[model samples]
Target chain A: EAGVTQSPTHLIKTRGQQATLRCSPISGHTSVYWYQQALGLGLQFLLWYDEGEERNRGNFPPRFSGRQFPNYSSELNVNALELEDSALYLCASSLYRTKVAETQYFGPGTRLLVL
Target chain B: GIQVEQSPPDLILQEGANSTLRCNFSDSVNNLQWFHQNPWGQLINLFYIPSGTKQNGRLSATTVATERYSLLYISSSQTTDSGVYFCAVEQDFGNEKLTFGTGTRLTIIP
Candidate 1:
């Protein structure tokens, strides 16, 4: 089975512009999560979607938002981007609701660069 | 929120050697995962051990949930093991999201 897939491996945008990242989870998976990994800063949780509902969001600003589709794929939107927003955006999926515990599988990540 | 820390920050080893990495979390967790981020930036799931012990080939992991710590052991390490090892956890005993550690950078010499 395919693990997880992401689109637009690399993106370059300027400040105040808008950017969107996409992710398709592994087949038969329900939960989709987004994270940001900056150069110095550690990986920070961005958003979590389950069964097409926004379950939880991190401490990021309102500009960082995302939604999950019926097929369990997700899209992360970053509006009014800033230089600090440049990072590797990763998406992970898990066999969450179907199993007792979850083992998240990650994608190759989309490198977002804001100038 | 839960905080995860990894040490010794970095490690350098020779081929055919062994190494151990540690991860400590601030609070209790029900979902603990160990991943290896390759040089090309792909996060590969290494283990999904929340508690107890598990072994896979030359790699093994042990998590003492009560103590809030986990150990990853790589025996007879190879050059392919050179990369960053990360430890992530899910809080509230749920699997919606994960908080990641800073990670340990391991380099193996030939």
Candidate 2:
């Protein structure tokens, strides 16, 4: 089976601009998760969507928002971006919400560079 | 919020050697996962072992949920294993959000 896939491998935007990243989960997966890996900040959870509902979110600001489609694909939107927003945005997917122990496969991630 | 701490923030080993990385959580967790961030910055899931033990190729992970800790072992480490290894846990009482540790940076010399 194909793994999680992300679009626009690299993006360059300026502060105050908006950026949108896309993710297509595995064919049979139902849970989509977004994470941000900023340099020196480590990997931080951004959002988690299961069955088309926003189940949980990280401590990030409202500017960092995303949604999952019926097909289980997800999109993360960053509005009024700041330089600190520059990082590798990753998307992961699992079979379903059966349990939290299920493995979450990840994508190559989209590197967003805000100037 | 749960606190996750990884030991030996950085390690360097020669190729063909073995290594062990540790992760400790402040609270009990229902989910524990190990990931390898490659040089290209891709987060590759190594294991989702909430309890018991699991192994894949040269990598093996064991999580003692009751003890609130997990361990990752790499046998015969290779140059490809040079990267940052992170342990993420989801607290049983939380919203299922993963709390990630600072990670252990591993470097393997040829």
Query: Which candidate leads in DockQ?
Result: 1
Task: List model 1 lDDT by residue over B1-110, tens digit each.
Answer: 68899997999999999999999999988789999999878899999999999999999999999999999999999999999999988876454678899999999999
CAPRI docking class of candidate 2:
medium
Per-residue lDDT for A1-115 in model 1, tens only?
A: 8989999899999999999999999999898989999999888888988899888888899999989999999999999999999999999987766336688899999999999
True contacts kept of 2: 0.66
lDDT of 1 at B96: 67
lDDT of 2 by residue, B22-102 (tens): 999998788888999998888888998989999999999998888889999999999999999999987753265677999
TM-score of chain A of 2: 0.96
| Residue B89, candidate 1: alpha-carbon lDDT | 88
Candidate 1 stretches greater than 4 Å from native:
none
State how far residue B27 of model 1 sits from its true place (Å). 1.6
Can you give the lDDT of residue A114 in candidate 2? 100
Error of 2 at B16 (Å): 1.6
Model 1 lDDT, residue B94, Cα: 50
